[model samples]
Target: MTLHQRPSLQSVPAYKQGKPAAAGASKLSSNESPHSPLPSVLDAISEGLGTIHRYPSIAAPQLTAELAALHQVDPQHITLGAGSVEVAAQLIHAVAAEGDEVMYAWRSFEAYPSLVRIAGATPVEVPLDADSKHDLPAMLAAVTEKTRLIFICNPNNPTGTVVEAKALEDFIAAVPRDVLIVIDEAYVHFDRSAVRADGVELFKNNPNVAVLHTFSKAYGLAGLRIGYAISPLEVAENLRKVAIPFGVSDLAQRAAVASLHAADELSVRINEVVAQRERMYEALEVAGYPVVKSQANFVWINAGDDTLDIEAKLADGGVVVRAFPGDGLRISSGSELDVDRVIAALASVREGAQA
Candidate 1:
């Protein structure tokens, strides 16, 4: 007899990571920081090496306290997870059930649908607007009685588009009090827009709102896998209930704390990434690609029918980018050299098409 599996998983596909670069190619496929860990962060990780045999502090009190102080929230409001994605899963399981619905923008985070499906909840995906930003009005319209959760991915992944502050405020006010709204700010540090929505600020007066943050992106702690959520006291408790025991390793916790304390050093790296992102956006536009103005550490090229062809051309030119088949391509901002390679590759594509 065949071993039993959940019927819901039958249609769900496994998550696909961005492709690794071939020899001599610049890997821009993954939205990862190109910088190495700071000396302070490395020292902290080294100090924790002796504690490997023991399980990490389940509550991660030190890191939790640091995060609370950083966000100006009480420690009770914080919950730690292996990563923000895991925190997202905990949030889904905390409030959603078999028939409950979880809503988000389509082509936002690729993991949303699978996470909801794994929780046995129905996924509600609204399409992005023409500018590739979240269609908040349409998302509000799609909410129903069964809607238990809504995720707004600010500076949305792959597209690098963000919802403005005022519009997001209105959307939050209009959402039902009982429906949990999670503002996933995985790329929050890279967003420098004047009107960018602050998730922590939004969560202050709104008990139904939660803010998710990760050390993976700006802090360059992706390999360590540490992230947290600031939410209502009750929501935090439930999130803790659903989280895996000792999911966050001791080294990750130490690295996150060290990274936070070394904020000045971290800021320099972030500024470098932002600079590169701007350079890339400008170059892509000059090459005749209708690139979106990204506030995150990447730019979106809406390649449409030419996506695959462009992907192949980029490969030939020793550069790699994340392609969304018929939709577009998302190129992570790497070093100055990487941006040069990407510009050269796309220039070749444009020249070939014109020829």
Candidate 2:
């Protein structure tokens, strides 16, 4: 039987977070680091847990202050959320009314389109270029009077492509004043290349632009689900209003604050991931797979792309990666062991092609 559906209740495509692999399998699917929370961060969370019987400081004052100081912005300029993804959704919900349109690049964050839909808004998806980077000009052209929000995911998820600062600056200039622009930089710290947008700097100037950042990536705090948005106070207040109360847990708030001080240590570890990403890219390219220049922790495999089929084969080889149907697989990546595992799995596929 066909199910009756309201426009808001229609089947909005869901974000496909990958399944966890078997205990011994190297899981590289969810873009989660193979690593765990830092020892100090773990200690911080443990300390916070002792106070769990009490409701966390809903304001997250200490955490927010640390974030404000780090970003060189006022605490009032920030709104903490469960993760940067949640912050992104809040930004859309803040500026858009039901049926108003939100625009973003396709295959960017699998979540963006669905999140907009769930907010009772229309999602406009502009396709990425052949190179897999966002076609910003085309996206700008698609913006309409109903376009209340635009999402720009730098070093975009799944595709791992980035918009350089110059291009980003140009794109921002063309955006209408009435529209809210969200720059999702969930994996920014993992990026070492110079060709990337500094959303923080952009937010410091443009009241219309809101930037979402998270400690999940380089800080090894994904489990804490701690992230925040930098926006004008007007926008920040709106986001805070729409947010579910106390979404940022006490432990998460505390751990994220501690993690912020470990940047020097995290940078060294992140550089290692960057090097491994380059190696993974080289290996895939050498084996004749189409790869985008990755500026994120993972590399995208555009395997022409039997994404699901390829994923199954990698699974047999004990490596779990993310598959996006026609877009191929996104290998969340790891150190030498994790990288080598995926390379071997893809290599086996390449060798079989010739057979």
Candidate 3:
């Protein structure tokens, strides 16, 4: 909000993040896991405490190596990020020139257009399909010579439907090689579907693509804010060119490294959430509200009703959910206690529907 801020910065809307509820209010607004950290991750963080006085490795080499190994890619193919959001923003800054256009599906991340405008670029948003799915065909047509960047939010935000893998591959084939395509797979961990786009694999031989992932979702480490990108060596080079050094702190780097090692345990926890998501989806669908097949941990409330009424009723009953101006309501997967509260709130809505 500085007077000297660039005009482009003026119209960029603030990102809306979910906050924890008051002292005792249970929070299910943010799409966060209701689980405790792994003991291994805690030990790593505690060990890192001894090195706080020293500056963190600017490159986050140890963590990068681990990530590369896990992804079966060379270390040069990796670039660490504070979070996948940072990696997404870096794509915009690194590729799009002022006045160039950055395109994405509307109601995607909510951050896409803002970050685009911040880069002194124009945002071309293609509205989602009537069912709230990304209109991939429309997005493909939105690109013009001015388009330098495009973000595909798989299992897209607010609406959890993932673009079919074949459609994604065909879309990539249609896009011009000069433009950088970012596959934001923040929720990949919870995806049990075999048909989802594998961005890392998609970018294997392609330099025009970048795959972003984060520990925030399935890793249950949102508080730590660890994420990374896998891309061609040249793409990684360009990302680092615009990336600020030491972007990730010592503690976060240590925690992420520990997390990669605790993979089996993390998978078990994610599967539990996936199971819960299925049960929630079936319950919602059975109750007569339309529910999309969610590939992520959270489910999208069909937005089929007046979201305001649904939101107000839920809040009054002591459950917190995120309702957009559209009919969409994002209900985070929660602990049994939190989930029960959400179910009770919905039960009232269900009755009102039948009334």
- The most accurate candidate by TM-score is 1
lDDT of 1 by residue, 176-230 (tens): 9999999999999999887889999999989799999999999999999988999
Tens digits of per-residue lDDT for model 3, 150-227: 888888887887888889899998999988888989898888788898888888856688888998888878888778
Poorest 10 consecutive residues of model 2 by lDDT?
Answer: 7-16
Candidate 3 similarity to native, TM-score: 0.95
Model 1 poorest ten-residue lDDT run: 22-31
Q: List per-prediction Cα lDDT, in the order shown.
A: 0.93, 0.86, 0.83
Off by over 4 Å in 1: none
| RMSD from true fold, candidate 3 | 1.8
Q: Clash pairs of candidate 2?
A: none
Residue 137 C-alpha lDDT in model 1: 94
Where in model 2 is the C-alpha error above 4 Å? 1-7
TM-scores, all candidates, are: 0.99, 0.96, 0.95
Q: Select the stronger candidate by TM-score from 1 and 2.
A: 1
Look at candidate 2 and tell me the lDDT of residue 36: 68
Clashes per prediction?
0, 0, 1
Residue 209, candidate 3: Cα error in Å is 1.3
